[model samples]
Target: MDWDKLRIFHAVADAGSLTHAGDTLHLSQSAVSRQIRALEESLNTTLFHRHARGLILTEQGELLFDATSAMSRRLDTAEARIRDSEEEVFGELRVTTTTGFGSLWLAPRLPALYKKYPDLKIDLMLEERVLDLPMREADVAIRMKEPSQADLIRRKLMSVHMRLYATPGYIAENGMPESLEQLSQHRLICQNVQATQVSAGAELVRELLTYDVRSTLTVNNYFGVLQATRSGLGIGVLPDYVVEDFPDIQRVLPEVESKEVPVFLAYPEELRQSRRISAFRDFVTEEIIAHRKKMRQESESGA
Candidate 1:
């Protein structure tokens, strides 16, 4: 089959109109229609049925569409790899990371990275949603939780030790919770990732003390919860590394400590050999390791 014809067919099927497909592909309307006709002839089956509303895919077209979609993605991945290898480290690197880490840590360090590799373009997407690496959704991912996907390469960046933190005003007004029993009297803020039965941080807090987890204000993002806590909203649990520099926030109860959450840097196994990925992975790993001592020192000082 002609790849160009198939590409046109895919565009037409997606747009549901020859004119729209032509505009998208920068081809004339007549050219698009001719390619579709050729594709149908080669396939020996009708692909689309036209109506006043739009073109509807026939049963044969739907089958072919699924296969072609996968093929197009694979081809795109191959092309990206080839282009990355051929050129200098000058292409775009798409990365997805959690909002808290991206905002607090990664965003600040990107300028230095850009300075080091002036030719490289970085697209940093701050989202909680896990992107699919195999589908080429993102070139790299930095997440708080470990990924279980077998096809990708996963590297543990660091373990984030969480501690209970509250603003000075909150502690002064509510008084510091000296022990587990006293913790129940203060308001607690929760950070929830999904609709899971229990959050790891919350579970750890519960396991450590007899505090009332029942009375809590839950937020979706970690940075929001941390900010809320910093503003004297309530006591919140956050990664030690994130709040280390905030002078207003103080660790409330040293007796109650949450378990450390592992952070992972993930990428497709095939892209491991690529210089861009390797360079990024190594830079991030070194940066995190360098900050490990500072993170520990902050936790200790706060305690």
Candidate 2:
């Protein structure tokens, strides 16, 4: 069987349609269909069943897909190894991170990295969603949550401490809660994502806010919650690093403590040995470690 034809068939099977696969592979839909047809003919078995939605994989196709997926990954890893052996840091480094951190921190520091390695090109994808690194969605990922995947390489970069904060105006108008028990009297801004997750920060909020806590406003993004808190809408529990720079917001109930959320850096196991990846990994690790103390100080000083 032609390797190219097998590759095309695999792409189509994974994408669920000829047009989608063609778009991904930068080939014409007809060419992709022809390749799949040729592969099926050579193998003397029907690979896909035609359906209204798209092509559904047959039994043979499913088995082929499983093997082909592994084979493709190995081939890609080998290619990466070969390129790295040439000592060139001149390839695309796809990075995935959350919006708040990417905007406030990582994006600003990228220029220094580029200055050091002019040949390296970076594709920064910032979103709240964690992109799958093992599936080649991103080369490296910086996430707020620890990765539970056993296949990938994961490292804890730092612990992010969160605190309850409110605008001075809101606190003055609503009467500041003297203790954790009085928290329910004031309006509260809740983050939907954080509320749904049982993190240390979430647990602390639940424990402290015993009074009829009003969750009038809900937002998915931390930045939105920060803005709401800054606008004097309500008090919100936010990362200290995120809210420290907002002059209008004041930390409330500093005694009401919560757990620290550990930030993690993750990447695929295959790319661990690549020179460029290793270089970047080392550089980022050093930078974060060196700045960890400063981050903590900034949080404490509300800088």
| Model 2, runs deviating above 4 Å | 1-88, 172-175, 193-198, 243-248, 296-303
Which candidate wins on TM-score? 1
Q: Where does candidate 1 clash, by residue pair? A: none
TM-score of each: 0.64, 0.60
Residue lDDT tens for model 1, 183-269: 678777756534332256767655544555446767776678788898887888776776545767877776566666789999998
Q: Each candidate: RMSD to true structure? A: 12.0, 14.1
Candidate 2: Cα lDDT at 286 = 78
Which parts of model 1 have CA positions greater than 4 angstroms off?
1-88, 192-199, 205-210, 213-215, 297-303
Per-residue lDDT tens digits of candidate 2, residues 176-280?
Answer: 888766776777775654544427656765665566675557766567778888899888877776543465788888876568778888899998776667767
